[model samples]
Target: MAEEDEGPQKAVADPETYRESLDAWMKMQMPAAEDLRVHAVDMPRATGFSNETVFFSATWSQAGEQTTHRYVARIEPPDGGLFPIQTRECEISCELQHRIMSAIKDSGVAPIPELLPFEPDTGVLGRPFFVMEFIEGLVPADVPRYTQAGFLVDDATPADRERMVRDAVETMGALAGLDWRTMGLDWLDVKAKGQPSLQDQIELYRDYVDRELSGREHPILSASLDWLDANAPSAPVGISWGDSRLGNMIWKNYRCASVCDWEAVSLCPPEADIGWFVMFDRMSYDDFDVPRLEGFPTREEQVAIWEAKSGRTVGHTIDYWEIFGAMRFDAIMIKLGDRMARAGIVPAEPGISIDNGTTDGLGRLLERQGVSL
Candidate 1:
């Protein structure tokens, strides 16, 4: 796998270094006489552009008893990250972790790993990182694409694959139905410069293109943003899982066991999330040559389940939202590609850009909208 081959070489911290730092921190948290030893401190090959996740096992002795636990540490990029802190309106990563976990508490929509602690002081490690219980389940890989190579397609029965898709969409629907303000998630409602949250996202992406990818011309993204501005939907506002997709979920027993990665949680139209989820699925097949798992819900079936569970119609705006989804991916890939190039992961100019698939896919959608890129 590309991730397995490249991840270890590109990792920012060594396993030995991680264990030393984590053990020291854990020892301080335990009783004075208690012993805290960390082992199996390996960064998962699933590290992505946004955050670094490392898994480890810890054994501690306290009051004549010893216990061992598996945990995950999600760390912010020590240097500049793909999503820069300056571009965001929320607090730092640690604070955001607390806020998101607090909002979803007792919601009963799906299981989430228990958030342990947010270490602000970088003295223990080079950068602040938060710990959570390590969820044990099947997480679809992205680099090779799950459809192309993963336990989901390689091992699971067709029925289980179908259940995975349906349950994942249902989880999204439950989230869209959530009352953010009632759940005390109003903190995610940042100042949108007097514009609706959806509009704010459009502007934000456009700004990212201009400032983050200066001297670059992304015709498809530019066209999609313009179309969004012209055809802004009047859909009801709701919570949007910014990175909504089946890949972000941990599956066990053919159902979504846990939904993780709330970095892009926001107040936006419900369609925004559905669009993202749909486009990601579409890309897996259309761009990567990865076939959709048999028995999974079709696009129409997914929408039907979403409407039933969310208790709202996507109406005629579903197409528009999907286009927005493709565009959003393109915008983020602009940064992702640049990051990889700077790190020498890939050449400065590849035949097809890192975001080529998403950009081309969005172009086809634009033609349907009578817009040219």
Candidate 2:
């Protein structure tokens, strides 16, 4: 199998120094343990662009017995990462992510890793980070495109692929149906006094693109934003897994083991998440020009699964949200391309971000809707 560019690396420069600091921090968090040692501290290569994810194991002796615990720490990037680290309307991204995951775990609406208390003291690792019990499962790889290769294509039977799609969509639907207020997650609602949540989300992305562009123009993104504002759908607000996609899920036995990546969680209509799910499906297969592996549900079939589980009529709202999803994704790609250039992972001129498949797909979607950029 051929490997694709994994994008920029976010690992800390010195693992030994970080390990020592993390070991000390663990000692403070686990006071009762004797001879506690942190080892195998490593920054995983297969991680998203938003946070620096570190995996490590700690062993401690207590009551004359030794216990080992494996953990994954999500550390805020000092550079504010791919998105703005702080915004007036929301908490710090890492802190917000932790709180959202905790709330979701409490609600029991979906599966999440067991979370530890969030540590805000930058002294621990030079940045705020949260720890969670490490989950072991196969995650669909994004590098080579899962639709083209990997477990889903090579190992999974057709029935297994069907089950995977069903479970994944059902999980997304359940999340879309969550009562944010009841779950104490209303803090995720960042809309102004009378602004619709969907509009607020669009504005937020608009602002993000503006800041990322820093005076450059993304005409496609700008036009898409206008279209979203003009054709925004009216729907009930619900929890949105901002970056919903199969690649973000951990699977075991063709069932979703856990939904990872909460950095993009927010309060939006169910269509926000549903749209992202389907849009990503298109990106993974259609945009990549890879034939979707047999057994996976069709785009419409997946939406039907979501409708059944969420009890919400998708109707034509999907068309609107799909455009919105593509816009958001393209904006992120812009930021990603900028980050990669600044880090020298890729050249800055003629950047890969602006004219990539994401933007192309966005253009096609917009053109299909008779919206011109």
lDDT by residue (1-373, candidate 1, tens digit) is 7633533233346789889888877777655546689999888664346667888998977789988899988876644344323125454655575457656756766578877667866556656678888878888889778878878777888888888888988888888888766676655655534233777677767776778668767677788889999999777667787778888988888788888877676677877888888788788877777567787678888888888888888867889889988777777677777777777787878723445777788899899989965
lDDT of 2 at 117: 83
Clashing pairs for model 1 are none
State residue 128's C-alpha deviation in candidate 1, in Å. Answer: 1.5
- The numbered model that scores best in TM-score is 2
**Model 1 weakest lDDT span, ten residues long:** 78-87
Model 1's TM-score against the true structure: 0.88
Candidate 2 C-alpha RMSD relative to the actual structure: 6.1
> What's the lDDT of the predicted structure labeled candidate 2?
0.82
lDDT of 2 by residue, 40-155 (tens): 98876633456788899999999999999999988876555564322353455678788888888888988999887888767577677888888889999998989888998889
